[model samples]
Target: MKRQIITFATLIAVVMGVGFSGCTKLTDFEDTNVNPYASTIPVTQNLLTGALRWLPATVNSDVGAIYAQHIGEVQYTDASRFLGINFAYDDFYRGPLLNLQKIIDFNSNPETAPTVVGGGSNANQLAVARILKAYFFFHITNRWGDVPYSEALQQSDNLTPKFDRQQDIYTDLFKELKEAVDQFDSGAPVEGDIFLNGNPDRWKKFANSLRLIMALRLSKADPATGKVEFMDAKSDGVIMTDAESFRYQHLAETANQNAWYARYLTRFDFAISEPFLDYLKSVNDPRIPALADKPTDGNANYVGMKFGLANTTGIGNNSISYIGSGLREQDSPELIISAAHVLFTLAEGEARGWNAAGTPDQVAAAQYYVEGIRESMKQFGTYDATSFAAYIAQPEVAYTPADAIRKISYQRWIALYLNGYEAWMEWRRTGFPILDPGPSPLSIDGEIPRRQAYTTLERDLNLGNYNAVLQSQGPDEVNTRIWIDKP
Candidate 1:
C-alpha cells in the first residue's frame, strides 16, 4: 500500500509539473536547482580587471583632453569652448567604485575571507583595493571638489550622503595611501593584479608617488602641509624611472584596445590643437611626428585645427593632423603617471625649497628637470642623444633661476601630453605655458573653466545634497574655484 501511494504521488507530481508549467512560477522550482557556478557574491580576483581597465579610459578621454588642449573636436565643440559641463558622477559611483568596494568587502569579511584570498593574503588584497579606492576617489574629488566622499557607495542605506570638503577628502586619501602601503604583505603576494603584477614593492612605490602628487596639489593652498607630505613620500621612495612608471599595457584586441585609438582613429573626429602644434613647432620639438600625423591633404607635416571652433568650417576633413600612430594605435599604452611626472614634481619641490633632493638651487632643479625631459623622450621612443643634446641647449629649453618654474612647468606639460587630466590640474595650479583657448560662442567670461559643474543627474536625483554643496561650495558654475585653487 505504501509503494502504491508513493507511485500515485509521483505520477501526480509529473502531471502537475507539465500541466501547471505556464501558470506556476519557474523561480519556485529554480530555488532548489541553483547553478553551482553562479553565486550572489562575486569572486574578489575577478573584480579588479574591470576597474583597472576603466581607470585609464576615464582619465585619458574627452573633457580633460579638451581642457588641456591635447585634442580639438572636429564636430560639435561645445566642450572645448569652456561652456558649462554636466559631468555625471553617478556613472563613477555605479561603475569602477562599486567594483573596488566589492574587493574590499570580500577580503575583509571573515566568512568570505578564505575564498577571496585564494592565492593572496587577506591583508594584501585589502591593501590593493584600498590603494585603488584612494586613487579613484582622488580623481573624483579632484574633478569636483567637496564631493560625497565619506558616505558614498552606501547604496540604498544612504542615498543622500553629505558632501565632504575637499580638504578633508585629501586628508583621508593621504591616510589611505599610508595605511595601504604599510599593510602590504610580501609573504602573501597579491594575485589577479593587472597593474603591478602582485609586486608589493612596486605597489609601495606607487602609493608614495600618489602621495607626492596630492602633496604638490596643495602647494598653493597650504605650502607647509604640502612640503611635509612631499618630503615624507619622497623619503619613503617614489617612482624613479620609466620602468617603474604606472602604465596600462593595452592589447591589440578590440576589447583591450587603447581608448583614444578606439575613439578617434576610425572616426577622425579629433585633431591636434593649434596651441600644442605651434608650441612643438616653435621648439623644433622632435616628438611632433610621434605626437601627431601629417595632414592627409599632403601637407607632409602637422597642422593643428583651431581649438573650440564652431565647426570644422574653412577646413577640409584631410587638412588637420590626427593623433600620431604611436599613441593612437590599438596597442598603445595608457600612462597613468610617468617617471617624468615624479621627477618633475621633485624638481619643482627642489626649486621651491620643499623636501626634495639636492640644494634649493637652480642647478638642483635643472638636474631633475632635464632628466624628466630625457625620460619623457625615451618613454615616447623618440630619444636620440644627439638631438636631445641640441634640444636642451636651446636658451628657451635650458634652465635658469629666473625661468626655473616656467621651464619645469612647461616641460612637465609637454611630458604630460595626452595625459590630459594631470596637464589640466597642473595648469590650474602653476599657470605656466599660458594657454589661449580664444573666444568661443559658448564661453563664460571668455575664460577657460576652473572646474567642471556638477551633473544634472545629481541635481535631479540627489537634489537636497546637491543644492547644499552648490550653496556651500559656490554657484553651479565652472568659473568658481575649488579649495585647492583658492588662497
Candidate 2:
C-alpha cells in the first residue's frame, strides 16, 4: 500500500508540473509581441487619407473669397463662418500645414513607398502621398517662414520638434522634390497612380513641376539657386503640362465629393465678401462669374467680405445668395494647385527675367496667362463663358509681365477657389494683385496674420519645441512669417 501511494503522489506531481510549465510558456508568448487587432497597412492608409482630407477644399466661397482679387464679385464681410479658412485666406498654411503633418508621417515610414494611384494596391498608394507631401510642404514653409521640421511627422514617436529655419527647410524641400521626382523614373507602369493614371512619365513631370515651385519659392531667398533650378527643369515641361500635372478629378460620388460643396448644406455657409469682388472687378479678371454665382448682377465690381466676419457683422444673414446678380454654380473641389499652373510658373519665372532657357518671360507669361484663363473659365457650379470672355477681353486686361505674375497668382488663387487660405498666403507673399484688409476688429495682432499661432494643442503636446520657436518670434499667430515667405 505504501508503494502504491508513492506512485500516485509522483503521478500527481508530474501532471501539475506540466500544467504550470504550459501556463508559463503562454505568458512568455503574450509578453513578447502583439497580434495587431488592426492591420497596419490599412491603418496607415486611413492615416494618409486623414491628412489629405484635412486639406483646403472650398467650404463656401461666399465666406472664403473676401480678399479674392480674381473672382471679382460679391460684396461684404461674411459672418465668421470660415474662421479657419479666412485665418489663412491665402490657402497658404492651414491645409498644407495641417494635412502635411500626416503626409510627412507616412513618408517617414519605410514600409511604404510613395506614388499616385488611379487603381493600384496599397503598396503603391504612397506616390500620391509623397507628391502631396512635397506640394503641401512647399506651401507651408514658404508662407509661415520657420516651421516645425525634421520631426513634424513624428507624432507617434515624439511630439515636440523644433522649428527649422525656412532657408534650410527650402533646401530640404528642393532636395526632397528632386528625389521624389527621380523615384518615378522606373518608367514602367505603376499599379495605382490616380493623378497621372499610373503613367510614370507623367509622375516625372509632376516632380519636375514641383521642383519648379520649390525653386521659385526660393526666388526671394536665393535668386541664383532659384534661377538655376528654373533653367535646369526647363528641359522638362513644368508640372502644368498635360503629360505631367497633379490633379485629382472630383466625382459625383459622395465618397470622393468636394469639401466646400458639403459646407453649403451646413449652417456654416455664408456669402462672398465685397472687398475681393471689387479687386477682381478692378482688374476685370474673368474668373469671378465662374467661381461665385451671385443672385444679382448690378455691381460690376462687387467684391466679397473677409471670410468669417459676415455672419458676425450680420451682413445678409438671411439672404440665400448675396452677391448682386452673380452666377450661382454647383460646388466642387477646385484644384488646390494645378498642372496648368506649372506652365504659369514658367511664364512668371520668365517675366521675372529667367526666360532665356526655353520661353522668354514676356511671351511665356502671355501664352500661359491666356491658357490659364481659358482653363479657369471652366465651370464649377454655374458660369457664363461669354461674360467671362468679355471680362478677359476688356481694355484693362492686358497681359504684361507684372500682369502675368498677377494673373498667375490670381488664377492660382482662384483655382484654389473655396480654398481661401492659400489665396490669403499668395496675397501675403506677392502682395498680389493686392487686396484691402476686410473688416476685422481683432485683425490678428494689428495685421492680417502672416502665420497663426501654432495650435495651442501642438504647443501643449510639444511644449518644449513650440515655446522655443515662440521665444524667437514672440506670440505665434497670423503675424508670424513662415520660412521662405518674405512678408
Candidate 3:
C-alpha cells in the first residue's frame, strides 16, 4: 500500500515537473497503467484531497491507543507490551507533507497560481496548505521529536535534512498556525477541504483551537510561554461548540469507511482496557456504554481486558467488551480536535491562573471544568441533564481547588479517548491518572515508552543528521523523552 502511494506521488511529481525525492523507488511500474494523454498541469484540489486522506493515520493509530491504555490486546500484544520501535515516518513526508508543499509552492508561484485557481483562491489554498502542514508537523514532532523542519520537503534540493530542535519546531509551528489563520482573505474558500468543507470560519477556529492545545503542551517545559500563547489563542477564538469540532468524517463505502469497521470484520485483537473501563465504571461515567459493548459471554457484562498481559491463554471475543458499535460503524467520524478538548484546555489554563476574560479564580476553573465534561458527554451522545448533574456531583468527578489540575487532567483524558496520540501526550505532560506499566512490560527498562525511536532508514540514509540528533536529543530510544515532555 505504501509503495502504491509512493508510486502515485512519483507520477504526480513527473507530471508536474517537481523533483520530489522524499521517497525511494520501491518498484518499477513503467509498464503499469499510464494515461499517455493525461493533463501535465498539476491540480491543487487533487493534491489537497490526497493530503487530507493521509490524515486519518495520524489520529487512528493503534499503537498510540495502546500506549494511552485506552485499548488492550485480546490476541497479539506486542504493541501493548511496547515491543515495536523505530517506526517509519517516511510515508508522512512522502505523502501528505509533500502534497501540501506542492500546494503552497504552486499557489505561491505567479505563473502556476492562475492555473490552480479552480481549486480555490490562491490565498485560501496557500492558507489551508500552511495550516495543514503545521498540523501534520505538530503530530510528527510530538511522536518522534527533533525531526526535519526548516529543510524538509525541499524536493531534490535537500534530501538529507537536518533535524531541528523540538523547541524550535514548536515555536515555528505556533507562528505558522497563527499566520495561516490570518492569511485567509474574503476570497473563495479552499477546495478539497474534506474535513471542514472549505469553511474559512471553521478553519480559523480549528487553527486557533489547535494553537490553544499546542500552547498547553508547553505547560511543564515553559509555563510562562504556555500561558501567554494559551491566552492569545483563546482571545483570538477557538472551537467553542460541537458543530465546530475538527473531525474527519468517513464514508459508508468500502473505500473510505471507518478503519475500526474494517479491523473488526475478521480480527478481535483489541478490547477496552481494564484500567480505563474500571475508571469509567468507578466514576459511573455516562459514556461507558458509548465507549464499549457488552461481552458476548451470555452474562451481558462490560468486561474489560487486562492490558499488556503476556499470558492471554483464554481471552477471546466472547470474554471481553469490543469497542462501541457507533464508534466502529462504517461512517463513524474520527475526531481530531473538538470543543471539549479546547474547553478542557481552557479549564486547565484557568486552573493555572491564565485567563483572557478576567482574572482567573477557582470558580471560573470549576465552571470550565464542568463545561468541558458536559461537552465531552454531548460529543459522545450520552449527555442528559439529570445524569450529567449526578455524574459531576461525584466526589471524584467534582472540581475542587486543591485537586483542580488533577481533576481537570482526568476529565481531559476521558474526553480524549480514542485519540490515543493526544491522550498519551497529555498523560506524559501532566502525569495524570498515574498509569502503571503492567507486570509484563517489555519496553526499554520495562517502562512505558515516552517517544518512538527514529526509523532505520534515517540512520542508513540520513546518517549524519540522525547521528547529530542522537547527540543533541539523547539516544534514539523509546525512553528518550521529548523536549515538551520535560519533568
Candidate 4:
C-alpha cells in the first residue's frame, strides 16, 4: 500500500513535474493513459488531500493504545506486554511528509506558484503546508526524542541527516507554528482541507492550541519557559469550544471508513481495559455507556478485560465489554484534538499560576476543570445537564483547591479515552491517576514503557547516528525515558 502511494506520487512528479523542479521528458509516449494536456506542475489540492489522511489515522488507532491502558488485546497480547516493539519512521517521511513537502516546493517557486496553488494564494498554501509539517514533526519528536529535523527531507542535499536534539526540535516547532499561523493571507482560502474545510482562522486556532499543549509538556522540567509559551499560545487564540475541535469526518464507504470500525469489522479482538473501566465506574461517569458496551453475559454492568494479560485465556467475546457504538459507527468523526483537552490544559496551567485565558485563581481553575468535563461529555454526545450537575456534586468529583491537580489529571485521563498516545504521554509527564498493569507474567520490568524503541532499520542502516542517540538518550530500551520526561 505504501509502495503504491509512493509510486503514484512519483508518477505525478514525472507527468506534472509537481514535487520538484524541472520537467521530465515524455520518453514513454506509447502510454495512452497519460493526459496530453496535463499541466507540467503539481496541484496543491492533491498534495493537501494526501497529507491529511495520515494525521488522524496514525493517532486514533496506533499501538500506543495498549500502552495507555485504553484497551486490552483479546489476542496477540505481545504489544500490550511491551515486548520487541520497534517503531518504523520511514513511512511518515515517505508518505504524508513527502506530499506536504511537494506542496511547499511547488508553491515556493516564483514561476509555478500561481498555477500550483489552484484556489489559494501561494502564501496561504505554503503556510498550511508549513503548519502541517510542524505538526508532523512534533508528533514524531514527541514519540522518539531526538530525530532528523534540520536536514530531513533534503534528498539531494543530505540523505543521512544527523539527529537533532529534542530541545532544539521543540524550539524549532514553536518558531514554525508561530510563523506559519502569521503567514495566512486573505488573498484566497486554502483548498482541499479535510478537517477545517479551508478555514484559515480555524487553522490558526488549531496551531495555537497545539502550541498550548506542547508548551505545557515542559511544565515540570522548565516551568518558566512553559509558562511563557502557554501564555503566548493562549493570547494567540486556541480551541476553547467544541465547535472548533479538530476532527476528520469519516466516509460510510468501506474504503475510507473510520479506522477503528475497519479494524473491528475484520476481528473482535479488543476490550476496554480493567483500569479504565474501574475509574469510570468508581466515579459513576455518565460517559461510560457511550464509551464502552454493557457486558453480554447477563450482567448489567460493564466488565473490561484485564490489561497486560498474556493471552485471551478466560476472556470471551460475549463475556467482556467492547468499545461502544459511538466509536464503531461507519461515519464516526476522528477527533484529533478537542475542546475538552484545551480546557483541561488551561485548568492545569491556571493551577500552576500560568496565564491561560483567565486570571490564575483556585476558583478559576475549578471552573475550567468542570467545564473541561462538560465539554468532553458534550463532544461525545453524552452531555446531560442534570446528570452532569449531579456528577460534579460528588465528593470525588467536587473541585477543591488542595486536590486540584489530582482531580484535573484524573479527569484528563478519563477525557482522553481513545487518544491513547496522548493519554500515555500525559501519564508519563504528570504521573497522575496512577495505572496498574494487573498480574500478568509478561511484564517488562514490571512497568509500562516510557518510550518506544528505535526502529531496527535505523539501528542497522543509520548505525553511527543511531548509536550517538542511544549513548546520549540512554539504552535503546522501552523504559529509557525521553528528554522531556525528566524527573
Query: Relative to the unseen true structure, what is the C-alpha lDDT of residue 300 in candidate 3, on a scale of 0 to 100?
Result: 65
Off by more than 4 A, model 4: 1-35, 356-360, 441-444
| Residue pairs with backbone overlap in model 1 | none
TM-scores of all models? 0.91, 0.71, 0.93, 0.91
In candidate 1 the C-alpha lDDT for residue 371 amounts to 91
lDDT of 3 by residue, 7-67 (tens): 5566675775443244355245454567888876788998999999987888888888899
Encode model 4's per-residue lDDT on 1-487: one tens digit a residue: 1222335555665766443344255454346466878877677787898889888755785477777888888877877777655787777887788888878888888887877767488888888888898888888877888887787776545646778888888888899899999999878887888867888998899899999999999977677888899999999898877877888888999866887888888797788888889989998999988889887789887998787777677677888899887887888987888889999999988988897444458877888899999999988889999999999999999988888888898888878788888888898899887887556634357678887777787776667888888788888777788888878
Error at 248, model 1, angstroms: 0.5
- Cα deviation of 187 in candidate 2 (Å)? 8.0
For model 3, the stretches where C-alpha displacement exceeds 4 angstroms are: 1-36, 356-360
Candidate 2 CA-lDDT value: 0.53
lDDT of 1 by residue, 1-487 (tens): 0111223546767787885678657666666655787866656777777677776855686788888888888877787887656676666676677778878888888888877666478889888888888988888777778888888876655767788889999999999999999998756787678878988888889889989989999989888888989889989999877877888888889988888888865588788888988988888888888888899888877899788876667788798898887897898888887999999998898888885443476676789888999999888888999999999999889888778889899888889888887888889989976998755647566788778888776776678988899888998777788888885
Residue 235, candidate 2: alpha-carbon lDDT: 67
Better of 3 and 4 by lDDT: 3
Distance from true position, residue 466, model 3, in Å?
0.5
TM-score of 1: 0.91
Better of 1 and 3 by lDDT: 3
Per-residue C-alpha lDDT of model 2 across residues 1-487, encoded as one tens digit per residue: 0111223546766676676685746555553445567443423444444445544443234333443332222233322421341123223233333444444444455554343222243333445556667666665554455666666654334445677877777777767666655554443343423345555566566667767766766666687788888777776656543323344555566676654455444443445555555556677665565545554434443335444343344444443234322222232444545655565566677778775654455876777676655555543322367765676676556576545666677666655555555566566767775654444534555445555445455455557766777776556665556654653
Candidate 2 matches the true fold with a TM-score of 0.71
lDDT of the structure predicted as candidate 1: 0.81
lDDT for residue 305 in candidate 1, whole number 0-100: 73
- For model 3, the local distance difference test gives 0.87
